[model samples]
Target chain A: MKLLQQTILEKGTVLPNGVLKVNTFLNHQIDTGLMIEIGKEFAERFTDSNINKVITIESSGIAPSFFAAHTLDVPLIFARKKKSLTLKDNVYTSQVFSFTKQETSEITVAKEFLAENDRVLIIDDFLANGQAAQGLIDVVKQAGASVAGIGIVIEKTFQPGRQILEDKGYRVESLARVQSLQDGQITFLQEQISVTN
Target chain B: MKLLQQTILEKGTVLPNGVLKVNTFLNHQIDTGLMIEIGKEFAERFTDSNINKVITIESSGIAPSFFAAHTLDVPLIFARKKKSLTLKDNVYTSQVFSFTKQETSEITVAKEFLAENDRVLIIDDFLANGQAAQGLIDVVKQAGASVAGIGIVIEKTFQPGRQILEDKGYRVESLARVQSLQDGQITFLQEQISVTN
Candidate 1:
């Protein structure tokens, strides 16, 4: 988490409308070494949980989710945004609104892939408004699987993303949690976890 | 390669319209172990090449690319289909037509990611019409980088994908080349070097 926070401070760019671009490393042009580290961090955080599968959305989240899934030695199931012609008719779909794209799209997963006994750990690159995470949760519910936890690379904690998931009784752990971006500087919650909190 | 071939024979579903769906283990729901095998095979195939990076497009190609890139200990750079607001204005863009989706989509990579001296190996899930592969090649060309080789998981040799690349003098290698899918049976060109010849 400290390394990720440092990487964000060094490489992440602050865009207008509260958008932080880590495309140079995290999302677009990935550093496999850093990706492996991030995956290891996720594994460490969720080591206590029983995770059978790692679920994520298309595009950006796939890379980190892949490393996490590989590190955890679990299967990764990504929900495709665009409906492929070859997709089977029977699929569990959930409508998701992207605050970044400002469009509503449906994310789908094949029903046969997720079983009732599977415990899924959801991973994503960024969590702002938590729409994407919510959509993934919907797909997991439709499959009748258990939601083990949510692993996020970066979280905009000032927003309602984390609160909503926590309200639903989900364990949401982010590598870098941004408290705010006031005065053109990024703030992170780097406090060590207490022995009993 | 044998493991991959066996996987295809077992899990791959040939759709009515010639679209082979291997989502169970390849794309949608990924098997990390098999993908690691695939990565090992790709590394073995291109062991002699000077591949500094493994380049691929997003969504489907990320998993295999990750495995292959990690095996080779090289960085992986993927072209994003949609330009996020966080993306810079400077990029190498190319239009790719998807036969299955029946639409044309543009893929772009940040200009800073690739350099003239970089030797890139292109990787993708399927090589059907090869538009996606060509589009990736175009990006590499735009960056003034040398393409080391093109690696594909499955190649539909009957389609015009391989011929176009071969005609362009590109070294294209597919793990599983389908000579013909006749009577619901797949014929592989394991002993043959060039499917076109």
Candidate 2:
């Protein structure tokens, strides 16, 4: 988490809006070494949660979640942004509104992937408004699975995403927590506190 | 690769419209163990190509590409399906038509991530009509980067993808070369031949 925070401070760009552009390493472009470390961090955090599967949304969420699933030695399931032609019927679908894209898209997972006895750990790249996380949680509920925890690479603490999920009683662990991005400066929450501590 | 072929034969579903759905293990839900082996296989195949980066399209491609990049100790970049709000300018863009989706979308990558001297290895989940692979190759070309090779998890040899890439003089390595899916049977091009051989 310290490495992630430092990477964000070094390579991340603050857009005009509240967006933090990490295309260099996290979003558009990925650092596999950092991602593997992030996955190990998540596994170390939630190792005793009895997680059977790791679920995330398509595109950006796939990389970190895949590594997490690998470290956890479980299967990784990514909810499709839209239902493709081959993915017809018998799917647990949820409508998610993306604050960034400013559009609503349905995320879906095949019902055969999740079951009542499964414990799922949800992972994603960013958690701003938490719509995507909520959608994955909804899909897990539809399959009668239990939510183990949520692993986030970067979280905007200024946003309501963390509060919303915490209010819902879901444990959320974020690697980089940005307290503010005002005046083109990145401010992390509790910068002095070590992640390992 | 043998494990991958066995997984395809056991779990891959051939849809009515010539689409083979391997969502059980490759697309939707991923087996991390298998994917790790896939990354190693790709690393072994392209070990001498001098690849500094591994590129892939989003969603399903991220998993295998992530592992490949990890094994190769390089960065992984996934082209965005569309230009997002954060990814505004200075991008290498290419148009890709998804035969299965029945729609065309533009893929974009940040210009800074790729360079003229970069040797990139492109990886993808499926090689059907080779449109996605072509789009990635175009992006790499636009950045003046040379493509080291292309690695595909499943290649439908019955389709024109493999032939097209081969005709263009690109080195393509497919883990499973599916010959036919007629009559709901998953047939490989050479079932008896070992991938290691």
Candidate 3:
């Protein structure tokens, strides 16, 4: 987490409307070395949870989740945002609102991929309002699976993303937490363990 | 490649309207072990090309591409389909038509991440009409980057995707080539190498 915090300070850019762009490393243009480290961190943190699968939304979250899934030696399922031709008709779907994109879309996972006995660890690149993670958790709920926890690369603590999931009694962990983004300067907050609390 | 062929034959579903679903292990629900192998294969195939970066589109391509990037010890960049707030304004953009979704959208990669001197290897989940890969190649060209080759997990040989790229003099490689998918049966064609030739 210290290395991630340092990387955010070095490469991250703060945009207007409380948007922090780590596209240079985390989301868009990824550093595979850093990605592996992030994945190892998540795997090390959640190794004791008996996670059978790592669930994430499409686009940004797939990379880190893939690394974590690789480390955990489990399957990683990315909920598709678009209703593609290849996606099956029998899917568990949940509507998600993206505060960044300012549009609501449905995220879906095939019912057969997620089973009732599976313990899923949700992963994402950023958690602002927590709508995306909530949608993934909803899909897991529909499949009757257990929510092991949530792993986030970056979290905007100024928003209520982490609080929303914690209120639901879900274990949420983020590598980088931005307490505030003001005047092109970013502030960091110490990570807290919600599961033990 | 044999393992991939066997996976498609066993787990893939032939959807209505020529849609072959391999999401059980390839895209939606990803098998991390198989993904690592796919990445290793791509790395081995493109090792002599001097690829500095691996380029892909969002959602599906990021996972395999990430592993490929890791294996190659280079960076991986995924083009964004939608313009988001966090993405920089300065980007190399191209339009891509999705036959599965029946729509066209613009894809963009940050200009700083892709350089004119960089040799890129394009990676994608499917090579169906090759429109997505073409769009990526266009973005790379816009940045003045050289494309070493294209790596695809599943290519529909019956479709015009691979031919379009091959006719354009691009080295395109696919792990599993489906000759036909009809009546709930899938026929696979052996992979052909264009890099050596």
- Number of the top DockQ candidate: 2
Worst 10 residues of 2 chain B by lDDT: B188-197
lDDT of 3 by residue, B144-193 (tens): 99999999999889899998999999998888888888787898875556
Every candidate's lDDT = 0.87, 0.91, 0.89
Worst lDDT 10-window in candidate 2 chain A? A188-197
Q: Looking at model 2, what is the TM-score of chain A? A: 0.95
TM-score attained by chain A of model 1: 0.95
lDDT of 1 by residue, B79-174 (tens): 999887666588999999999899999999999899999999999999989999999999999999988999999998889999999999899988
- Per-residue lDDT for A1-197 in model 3, tens only? 98989999999988776678788888899988888899999999999999999999888888777779988999888999977776658899899998778899988888888999999999999988999989999999998999999999998898999999999999998988889899989899865568864
lDDT of 1: 0.87
- CAPRI accuracy category, model 2: high
Question: Model 2, range B1-197, lDDT digits (tens) per residue?
Answer: 89999999999989988899999888899898898899999999999999999999987898877778988999999999988999878999999999999999999999999999999999999998999999999999999999999999999989999889989999999999999999888899975646784
lDDT of candidate 2 at residue B132, scale 0 to 100: 99
Docking class of 3: medium
DockQ of each: 0.74, 0.85, 0.79
Best by lDDT: 2
For residues A1-197, what per-residue lDDT tens digits would candidate 1 score against the true structure?
88889999999877766788788787787777788888888888888798989999987788777768887898889899977887868899999998888899999898888999999999999888999999999999988899999999999988899999999999999989998876667889666777975
